[model samples]
Every structure is written in C-alpha cells, then in structure tokens.
Target: MRKPQVHWDDVEIGGELAGFDIEIKPRRVFLQISGSQDWYPVHHDPAFARKGGHEDIFMNTGFTQAALVRMITDWMGDGGFLRKLYFEMRRQQRPGDTMACRGKVTDRYRKDGEGWVEVDVWAENEREGVTSPGRAWVILPMRESS
Candidate 1:
C-alpha cells in the first residue's frame, strides 16, 4: 500500500508526466557506471570512445534506461509500480549534454481488478534531439476508482 501522488481516477490519456533535467558531467557518468556495474571502457574512457569514433565517453544503455525509469516513477510516485519499460538509444549521451527526461501518458485502463497506465517516454539532449525513446506500463493505485 504505497501513497499515490496520482490516482488512477485522475489520469488522462494525453496527460504529461513531470520531467527531469540533468547535465551529463563526468561525475554523473561515473556514478551511473558504478551503480549499474557496467564497466565498458567506452562509458568511462574517452580515449576508447574516441578510438571507436565516438565524440567522447558517453552514458551507457543501462544508465539511459534508468533515466527513463526515474522519470516515470517520479511522476507516478511511490504508490505506483513500473510493470514494464522499453527504450532505445538513438544517439550517444556524452558529457556536457543536458539530458531532458520526458514522458506523456498514451493510454490508461483497468484490468484484472487493477489500474494501469501506458506512457511514452524519452530522453532528449540539448546536443541531439532524442538520445533515447521508449514506453512504460505502470500500475497505479485507485482512488475511489472501480
């Protein structure tokens, strides 16, 4: 029983989720690398990334996914559960890029005595339009919903 910032009854198909912005500094990238345990040199080694023809050391796939999850979960609050999430990295997220995490409600429905919401999510960088694009399904608590 988690307390909800948003109730099932209050959601709309086209509603927007709260967005988060972060500057992709080396420290942040290091933290992401550490937290995810993804030690790919490309994530932390600029030389390796440059050797691979990338501009600079960049955020990894797992970090990108986590950003999307953070955006959805922050919007849904502790009352909700992230049932499913899917995303793709279209471009590299490098240091000095500002990552803008955004989401929009695509659908809302109830099934099996539970309330669910479908949201389209993405991370847009100032340098590149969208580095990651995805979707997520969340289970939110009902408020006088039937």
Candidate 2:
C-alpha cells in the first residue's frame, strides 16, 4: 500500500497511520545506550547479559523511544515539527529483532492560525512485543489550495 502523505487539512480527530519496521543491530545499540562511562557488563557483554536473565546485550530504553520519535518525524516530513512526545517501555528489544513504529491521529485543530495534530504512537518488537507506546503532538504547515 502507498504511504500516507498527511496534509494539515487531511488530519482528523481519529486518523490512523501505519509505522515502518527497523532492525536493531549491535552498532545501533551502542549508539543508543549512552548515559555513563560505567562498563556495566549487561550493556555490552553478552555473557553478563545472559547471566542477568537477558538473552544478550539489549538496546537502551531511551534509544528505542527516540527511534519512535524519529519514525514519527520521518512520517510527518520536514514541514511538520514535533510539539510534544511521550512514551513508556513495555518490553526489551534484543539485537536481530525487527520492530514497527506506528501512530494514529487522535486530535487536530488550529491554533494561532497554524495547524496542529495530536497522535497516539507505539513501537512493537517481534521479540519483545510492544517496546514502547505513547502520544505525540505535531504542527504541520497549512496546505495550499490546488
């Protein structure tokens, strides 16, 4: 199916949007797990992760959440700006797994003569289920008349 190209006027109170899939690799995981210099074995050591009850080293929650935002921005395009974004982690995302990021428009309105859209968003991992789910608000440029 063709992807959605949502104009400011095309958004509604309950419009839904499909998410795209992304695969998590070790290198990506390294980029995501950034906080401290602590060499926590679980984060980078597969052996330690296994001992900690995880199958292997996993990506950081913050990184996965950020991916959700990137997904939304890519979907909305450069003409859209993110106003608000929030998410909660539901599961762990191990390497080699693919996950989907999705969103649905729950509200839309005009403020200060600009168009805004609110969306319910989520990220689902094949190995760990819905890794994150949350809401976002974006302001898109007004569409021009044909």
Count clashes in each candidate, considering only residues at least 3 apart in sequence or on different chains: 0, 0
Model 1, 50-145: lDDT tens per residue? 999998988988888888888887888988999999899889788899999999999999888899999999999878898888999999999873
lDDT per residue for candidate 2 within 1-146, as digits (tens), equals 55456678877777677578878787766666564344566767899899988878866665666677777887687678998888887677778988688888888888988888889998887666777879998998787761
The list of candidate 1 runs beyond 4 A from truth reads 1-4
Q: For model 1, what is the alpha-carbon lDDT of residue 49?
A: 89
In model 1, which range of ten residues has the least summed lDDT?
A: 1-10
TM-score of each: 0.91, 0.74
**Cα-lDDT of candidate 2:** 0.76
Q: Which candidate number would show the highest TM-score if scored against the true structure?
A: 1
Clashing residue pairs in candidate 1, if any? Answer: none
Clashes of 2: 0
